[model samples]
Target: MALQIFNVLGREKQLFQPIEPGFVRMYVCGLTVYDYAHIGHAKNYIAFDVVVKYLRHSGYNVLYVQNITDVGHLRDDGTDPIIKKALRAQSAPMQIVEMYARSFFEDMDALGVIRPDISPRASAHIPEQIKMIQTLIRKGHAYEVNGSVYFDVTTDPDYGKLSNRRIDAQQAGSREEIRGEKRNPEDFALWKNAEPEHILRWDSPWGEGFPGWHIECSAMAKKYLGDTFDIHGGGIDNMFPHNESEIAQSECANDADYARFWMHVGSLTVDGMKMGKSLGNFVTIKDALKRYRPEVIRMFVQSAHYSSPIDYSDDAVQGVARGHERMMNAVRLTRRALATAPQTDDGNAILAAVEKARADFTAAMDDDFNTPLATAALQELTREVNALLNSGTTVGASVLKAIAETYDQLGGAVLGIIPATDDSAAGNASREAGLIELLIKLRSEARAAKNWKESDRLRDELAALGVILEDRADGTVWKVN
Candidate 1:
């Protein structure tokens, strides 16, 4: 089957088609860079990361752009979160931006998320934002009042098309305050007049001000990915005013459609409650890495559809971790059997299983990226291969090689839950195995020398790292859990 995506624009599963054949242009709204990234951020980015990887694997040249909002992301009370964080820490706004921007990328890298092709910062793209606002004002889609610009929601009759809300149904001044400067309560700011105490300010035709939260995205997406792109994505929480305003203003200013497909990841909750710092349940990416491997985290996220809400808890992630280990063990055992197996005369049963797993994985992915089902296909293959390997028959080298390749392609490349057993990775594995053997030898020597305290310490430490040492009558053997 061909690829299909649940485009939020139409609220249906549509066949995947890019604006240009053999190429895809995509943009996702990035973080505001005021603090460290959390698990919720990990879920959102990992969803898009897999999308980009799958698109490229399907033979499309993809150019992905994500923006960084360093300024002008205002609260409902007209305060910038960056400035608020900076003041609380007694530092400059740019200092806070620089620190957390690095922190955000570090966390994403640890989670195995691929970086975007272009990361345009809002502060660096002021000229482009100013030009777009000027175009809106000249086209009568916006108005300047008291050195500030507001997008006239009434001017664009299709104002709430994306959110499917009528202008009258929306609470006026719900985001921004009701003021005499706005013609209507639902009108949002295109550019805000910076107060004298504002840390981040720029000179514009309207005065010294900054771009609004919504305009920054519209301007940056237009500049990097063109006026219209193939896909635009972000968290579903931003679908209402942030994404809705982006569509209305971009179409009005450029006289073209904004994005062909809109993809939104569902919100992530912690143990059936919203994750928050005040709630004492916030899981930062850094803190999560302390307890779980990056691959484990990726597997937990892929256990659910990208468009479906997921709950994060220790029990949930621990289950995924065990599943990930099962798959990895299958690959490890297959490679070990391949080392001494005969070259020819193999039955086609294992090879057929490999082919069936590949087809099943692709089919699941094609049906709107149904990752849970795709992973189930992998687990099924793992079970079959494990049974074959443990049976009293010698699997041929060619059959084992085929099984390994399928895991590399489907699990490593597509879902990113399994690491490729390439030369480099194999070398690392060999080194780790050597270290464990050496520790076991030292512990054996200590036991032979009747040093009970030191021997017990070494054995306990290795067990802490999931390496169990069994003392048999023949010798000592070790296994990783």
Candidate 2:
């Protein structure tokens, strides 16, 4: 099956046909960099990360760009300029940008989100943004007012095509308390004039100010991916004002479609409420990582479909931990079985199973990147491998090796789980020695007291830890192998 992706712009699952054959250009809106990253951020990025991984696995060259919104992100809840709010709060814009950008990257790295090919910051691309805004003004799609530029949404008949809202309807929806300078209520700013106290002011044709929130994306995306690109993605909340304005300004400026496929991941909720800092139920990624394993957190995020809301909670994370442990145990057993099998030249059955699993995984992914289903397929394969290993049939080493390779490719390379095993056993040896010494000391104490129960318990515990103890003719001996 051809790869199908749910294009939010068209509101349909369309077969992905890259503009350049065999190459894909994708962009995702990054964090605003005003606070530490949260599980919502993790869910969005990891979902896209898997999409990128699977696309490459299926033989597509993807140039993925995710922009970091370090500036031009407003602070106030309503339509007032965010920079004005920042100035009133007496916080330097760059200071806020630097502090939060660092926190965002740290949290993302902890969550194992592969850094985008190009992470353009809005502040760094101000010139590009200004240029685009100028082109929009020249094209009569934008106008300057009081040293600020605002996109004239009234000029673009298809302004709300992506969000499927009529311009009149949007104007009616936004009728109350409209800004007097805007030609229409639906019009959005391309540039905001800086007050004397605005710390992020820059020299622009309009005035000394920063680019607007939506303009940075249009500018940077066009700069890197051309006037048109394969994909543009962000949270669903950006659909109306942010992305819609982007479409109007960009298409009007360049006289071309901005992006072919628009993808928006759903929100993350906590206890049935949307997870936001203002909502007071937000949990930062750093705080969650301190409690849960990073892999468990990732698994929790991936448990749901990208276009659906993922509810965050302690119970949910614990459930993910349980599932992760099961997969890890399966991998461990597969490795041991492979190590003990006899050598052989050929193993067709194992090879066939591996091929089938790969094919099934790809098929599921191609169908709109159905990760939840793809993950289920992987779990089923792991179950089959474990069952085969425990059947007590004599399997050849070649077959076992094939099973190991499949597990590594799917689990490590694709899913980003299961760290690569190193050839040196120094770490394992040290751990084994420490465990053995502790177990022997406990067993001797149990024997001294003639406590059979305690002695058996100690032996069982060691066995659970992958250690085996045997009573020899001379004395008790332990062998790691």
Most TM-score-accurate candidate: 1
- Candidate 2's clash total is 1
Alpha-carbon TM-score of each model against the true structure = 0.91, 0.86
Q: What is candidate 1's CA lDDT for residue 21?
A: 94
Q: Per-residue CA lDDT of candidate 1, range 112-149, in tens?
A: 89999999999998899899999999999999999999
Considering only N, C-alpha and C atoms within 3 Å, which residue pairs clash in candidate 1? none
Assess candidate 2 and give its lDDT. 0.78
How many angstroms is residue 254 displaced in model 2 relative to the true structure, after the best TM-score fit?
0.8
Give residue 118's error in model 2 in angstroms.
0.7
Q: Model 1, stretches more than 4 Å misplaced?
A: 169-179, 345-347, 421-432, 438-461, 469-481
* Model 2 misplaced stretches (Cα beyond 4 Å): 77-92, 169-176, 345-352, 421-481
Model 1 scores a C-alpha lDDT of: 0.88
lDDT of 2 at 135: 91
